[model samples]
Target chain A: MKKKIICAVLIAAVILLSCCAILIQYFVGGKERIAYIYSDDKLVKTIDLNSVEQSYSFVITNSNGGSNTVEVRRGKIGVTQATCPDEICEKTGFIDSPLVPIVCLPNNLVIKISSSENENIIPDTVTR
Target chain B: MINKKIVSSIFGIILIIVLSSCNSQSVDNRAKESETDIFAMDTYMSLKAYGENSEKVLQKTSDKIKDLDEMLSVINEKSEIFKLNNANGEQIKISSDTALLINRSIEINKDTNGAFDITLYPITKEWGFTTGNYKVPTQARIDELLKYVGSENIILDNDNNLVSLNNHANIDLGGIAKGYAGRCAADIIKSEGITSAILNMGGNVQTIGAKPDGNNWKIGIQDPNDSSDIVGIVEVADKAVITSGGYERYFEDENGNIYRHIIDPKTGYPAETDIISVTVIGSDGMTCDALSTSLFVMGIEKSVEYIGTKHDYDVIIVSSDNKIYITSGIAEKFTVSSKFSEYTLNTI
Candidate 1:
């Protein structure tokens, strides 16, 4: 019985160690970050967040006279101002993950992020 | 006792080896799933394929989509639609693909009782939706444009692949192009022996098969009020989920009034409805794409009635009043997110 207990504990420890190794590798390894800005459903700019040394802001204007002010800082990006009535873009703040995007419907603008390693693998289209 | 100990020890060793093999196999399978995104049809499109030949299949599918974009785009000065639109009341020769799509559109228009019309291009252009310079046309101007907004005005001669427009009507395939492209992409992926894939054209989703792990794909439904929030999620397999919402594309006027891009062919105005978004799920992408727009314009009561008559697709309608109406066919597959829990959920 004592031998059996030792064997079970050994198996459990091995499983635990493997799980920790995977977690450490995933969280500790640096990930490459990229952000894409689209205006009127057209990709207008691509930014590598890791390469952004200084924070900057730019303006995007659509054909309908609508505009969005986008700000990019280290490791993150967001829309600071927009002419849309809802102001949803401004409220979205900064996004670091590719799961969500900053969108201004009135201006027809979207900002999305993705890891550089998986950047090419990012699906071509997302529908809301 | 010694024999029992040996048996248990051997079983433990086998279990360890099995577990380790599973971990490595999962990693290998993940690497096999390949994806690519392209810009076409004035929208972002993504294709993901799973299997050993995923990379090759994805590339071919992307090229197919690009080819379709060139052939069908109304805004492209050299496209078939553009050439046909510029024909000015004269019969023009069109490719069989274009003719087939037009014929399908005409059939759908008749089914929807003119709720969906391809000849609303003049009004769409006047509203500046096509050019992104939006202007609310006057009621009188809308009346003038309405005369040209009828699908019956389009005549197709299937024998010679000829198409003509009456009263100088112009055709725009913007409403159904993505869905059509998605359908064609699925065909390509399937022909390549890719059993599992997802084709997304600006929110029009077409699944080639169940997930490789034998699970349904979980698709999130965006909240019309909050762009970042997902109001619900639906599990689906081998299906298309197409959404049409006022929030998808719109412009704010100087007076702060928001006008959506979906023009109601009957009123010559942007569709005024209580529903903010409509998500349609079906086996065919084109039908889902067209119906999402048509049902959105139909509003709540009419949409429910119309859907009851049709049995091919199911819908989830999010109304401006914060209520979600899901048809019974997909109610079991859909889960309302916590953010929208306070809103009423009616399974019809």
Candidate 2:
């Protein structure tokens, strides 16, 4: 009887341990590593940080004559320069989460990140 | 007795393994999120659908929003609004979407007692808000344009899908079009079997359902003073959260006074109010969109009074005095962020 109770308790503890592991994985395992660049609200470029071997930079100019310079390094992306008055986008630095977006209101530019798992899920249109 | 205990123990072990595995596996499956970003309605629009058909649903929903953009854009020369604007007081045939938006605008105009009006295009144009010139219109110029700044002057015939202006009033649906598009996008996402989705037209957000994990979707309310800072977080499910603030679109004048894009129909100038921003949360995106603007114009005391008369919405008002007021309905779900910890939080 004592052996049976010990066995049951061991099984329960193992199950509980595995449950905690699963919870941790679900909450912290996936990180979005791809970034997208938008000019005037249009998706103009996409960068895959996981595959990036070296740092690179590019400039995007909107129809309204505003411009933003974007930089991408290993595992990170940011706006290095912009002609907008606020300079908020440049100060935002590098970001890698789908939740945080670097936006330049004067240039109508935005840089957003998405996980590789969500790369194909394109939203139809943005209304702002 | 030992045999019975062993049998039950094995059964319990099997059940534990099965149940825990199911929980983790189901969560993993539901975490599949499909998102798309497009430019429409003068802002970056993002749609995210979480479910089996997320990719296809997002594509279809994006197409729907783009179609609406093409049909409703005032600057798009071939759009219904463009044709109607250029009609010179003549009845112009419009698309069903354009007619519906006009009807909704008119309804909101009456509901807000003329606080929300789409007929302020002439005034806005003169102020260079649309042209990006950022000029202050003379008082004489504003008074002349104010004559055409009433939604009552526009007529919509739903049956024939026609629209007409009584006094050459040009309508600019910038105030409410984004919200209308968000509602339509949410509808498309739901109809496509996307049980969970978020439609963010700039800051105006509409959720189709709760997060797949059964937790409420947490939305951060942007601080009116700082673009990067969020003042609070709102937890909601299947609701629309729309924010209107003077800080969103504005220009600084020669002497350093700020002019917001939201022109007051009554004054023919940028809305002058102590309230910095107004956020409306409701099931209807369009109403929340219009109410955000209307409430911003109404200021704090009148907005609280206006909300008291309504049952379907809650509000978060941030005044220039640094006080944040949340309606009782949303007070429990709202959490003041550290950015606004210094500010007072009042429940109305």
Candidate 3:
């Protein structure tokens, strides 16, 4: 009976430790995948979510497709370039969150950035 | 032995369920769904469409339109617009949707130099364009109504959310409202993770991502001479293309003269020009829609010159002769239908 209790305690400890490891990894490692903008499986831009001053304006495109010159400044991102008649994508204005994608339908492109990351990464505090 | 096996099985089952649930949740969080569905609305008057992240939101967007109609219909005196209009030029606080439209109208009007005037409603009312019963208003009546044609006369303060008209000017936003709705609909779709969509608001279109097959959207520009005929086609992606023409809504006089709904603000009469249709492509649907009318009224020469000097705008002018002229910027994206062998591309 004592042996069974020991085994049960050990199993429970292992499970709890595993869950903790997962939670830490998710909060830490998952963040690395988020920079500023991810386009075509590459880190196109990385942003500091906390600093309200952290903003950028850049354009990206390949030879096959037309350029999608996006402007990111003051926590807002918008399309500034396209080959289409209606600059609807530029009119989409600034998208500050990852949920709201700045998309240009005619250009087949999307620009989005992680929002909460700006809040969590403080640098000084050690999270154990 | 049997009891031990049962205990182990229960644990295993619970573990699998928990693990699977977490996996699915994580996947759901990463992927977002978005969509823009285009279809006809009111038979011939306008095209109604909505974009959303989920089917429920899309339905809600449609439902919101229905609700908006109840509030915006001129016939409904109790509606928000009617109440606002009846206030003897008093400013009225409105809902978010109405506010968004009002702000866009004001912005477009400012940007277009009164050429895209929504306050032309007074003149339009005289012509009965909104009534669907078209008639030619006399020159005297047109001149009388032209007094209230200035968009600058419409006072709007965004911070205070106040709107007032200096003259007896009645604002009708129908010209750019559909395009505004297209922009809003696209916003909803991007939130939903619907990567691919095509939104056709009657003649104005907004496309996002690409077709599932990964090709651009083929938008057909109809020939004003024949509805069955397509003058040309323009390939668009992640943008909007809108057309305005004096031929869209018009009535012929006894002299066999055609007067269309697109009245020139300067003359308070239908714009006379050989170019029947003007399609403007821009990043914003509302801008394109409003500019399409303004540039059409401005005529081919001035329109071409104006857009030529400006950056980030292009136009396709379809002439009365079935010939098409695309701006130098967008000439490459337009393709002529072989059926119209006589038609050729001209970029001046």
lDDT of 3 by residue, B129-233 (tens): 666556788889888889877866767776776677677777776777666666766676666666666665545676666554466666667656544245567
Q: What is the C-alpha lDDT profile of model 2 across B49-133, one tens digit per residue?
A: 8887899888988898888888888889988888888998899998877888889889989988888998989998888776566
Can you give the TM-score per candidate against the true fold?
A: 0.80, 0.78, 0.61
Pick the TM-score winner. Answer: 1
What's the ranking of the predictions by lDDT, best on top? 1, 2, 3
Each candidate's DockQ: 0.21, 0.18, 0.01
**Preferred candidate (lDDT higher): 1 or 3:** 1
Model 2: residues with Cα > 4 Å off, grouped in runs: A1-58, A62-66, A69-100, A103-108, A113-128, B1-27
The pairs that clash in candidate 2 are A121-B35, A122-B36, A123-B36, A124-B62, A126-B45, A127-B201
Q: Write the per-residue lDDT of candidate 1 for residues B151-205, one digit (tens) a residue.
A: 8799888999999999979999888878888888888999989899987777788
Q: lDDT, candidate 1, residue B330?
A: 97
lDDT of each: 0.82, 0.80, 0.63
Candidate scoring better on TM-score of 1 and 3:
1
Summarize candidate 1's per-residue lDDT along A8-63 as a digit string, tens digits.
Answer: 67657766766776566555544678899989778999998877999999999998
What value does the lDDT take at residue B341 in candidate 1?
94
Error of 2 at B342 (Å): 2.6
Q: What is the interface RMSD of candidate 3, in Å?
A: 19.9
